[model samples]
Target: MDHQLTQNLEEYSASSTTIKFDRPIPLLRAPSRPGLPMTLTGPYILAFKDLPSWAAAYKSCESKIIAQCEEGARIGCAITASNKCKPPWWQSLTGWKSMDLKERERCEDREMEDCLVSAKEKCMGFAKEHATTPFLDARIALGEGR
Candidate 1:
């Protein structure tokens, strides 16, 4: 295994919290098997942890939104379909400006739910820009992003 290659590739995370493959390039190819795609989609959970209670998490996330607003930061929330690369396996904390604390919480929950259902479909728009095949599964281990 190319340690450097793995490191470089692993470092290449995508925003919108999805992980996909780019046409099975030799270095980036995902596992090849019949049920591989399903396995790749994974039980990777989109976790939102830390910040203690929901209220606290809400507040922390809200603070980010407020800070962004004050700084005139752009709020961006997108699925993989809209992105230009093969959908990434991760997403940064984004798109907080257009929502209030409650809205953020709701959106978070909704996105999590969406991840459970048709993740590829939900993120299809961004996927076009980032053409890819099914590879590794993505689990959003929260608490780390904050």
Candidate 2:
């Protein structure tokens, strides 16, 4: 057993409020197993103390969102099929004065801020709908450029 690895894992686990387990989480791994993926050779993470709660929370969060995520991902993929971040053709239209360009940029910034705020609020709303406690709230951090 790697004492350093166990100590590091313990240190990290201590910071999480949701999971509580024994001091030294018994780590187990087989060098090889039947039907195992070729890429999977790492130790299996096991924390039995509060597994039921964690599993239940994870399952609950996933159950309803399976279909929703699939559909949402499909729509999102379709919407961003051409993942180019280039400004719309209208933004590159005929020449304009500096003031006009600056004002347009300002308007665009405001619109982007508003959209980001609304998107985060909607994400939180969805989390709250399925979350019984703040600890159970699930969030996915999307890239700003995405």
Candidate 3:
């Protein structure tokens, strides 16, 4: 059998739950600017050795970030579909069998970005307002600019 066919067969038999990514991708939202949103939804791997400091920072906030990313993906997917917007091509590529995969992924990525940006802003604002919470500080430490 051809490799693609074999891979497809393997995929079908595989447990979907077992195929987890290091990062649970957020859905991208459609662009209001009449084009694709910037960002893609895929398994984003962070090599601890490459950027240990950033990795540590992200680790500290992993739970929060993951939760937010998931929420963002949900919102983004819905909005993107409604707006009929797509995300950048560099993100995830859908198979030919799934005609809407491209657009859906695009939308999801956009939503995810939006959620991240919003979370960053909120954290920054709380940091400024409370001066003690450090919620924003934590996010900033993870490379989310204030």
Candidate 4:
């Protein structure tokens, strides 16, 4: 199969015009995630003796980060949506009325910002404790480091 694919690629590259092949060329599919496969590749087996443990830790961090971000988004959406409803009894009794549309939007924006900042802090704390070096390195590369 490898020989046949290489031959097909060579033939395709040599031809200037579109070349119709008798068989479809096979392509390599990337793993769903960016990390190495469950099994280590050649020459790296010694370095990854505990690959499963590392993978689990990486996945745990990933899940926690996703959950935190989702919660933040949920909180922001709830706040923005709640603004459309009437003020609570305590607030109404204290002369705090429901804000106008523009004011409500501003308030929502501020609340969302606060929620995201808190979420980020939580995620960073989790990463510090549970994430693998490579995972943290990647976050740093993406400008999300602590």
Best by lDDT: 4
Q: In candidate 2, what are the lDDT values of residues 1-146, reduced to their tens digit?
A: 69999887887784753667569854222122223332232333222224455556555665565546545644554344323333465655655423355655566556555555555556556655655343332222235695
lDDT of 1 at 122: 35
Candidates' C-alpha lDDT: 0.39, 0.48, 0.48, 0.55
Q: Count the backbone clashes (under 3 Å) in each candidate.
A: 16, 0, 12, 0
> How good is model 3 by TM-score?
0.25
Q: TM-score of predicted model 2? A: 0.28
Model 3 lDDT on a 0 to 1 scale: 0.48
Q: Each model's TM-score, in the order given? A: 0.18, 0.28, 0.25, 0.35
Query: lDDT of candidate 4 vs native?
Result: 0.55
Per-candidate RMSD vs. true structure?
A: 24.3, 17.5, 23.5, 13.8
Best by TM-score: 4
Q: Tell me how candidate 1 scores on lDDT.
A: 0.39
- Per-residue lDDT, model 1, residue 98, is 36
RMSD of 3: 23.5
Judge candidate 4 at residue 46 and give its lDDT.
18
User: How close to the true structure is residue 134 of candidate 4, measured as C-alpha lDDT?
Assistant: 47
Ranking by lDDT: 4, 3, 2, 1
> Deviation in angstroms for 76 in model 3?
9.9
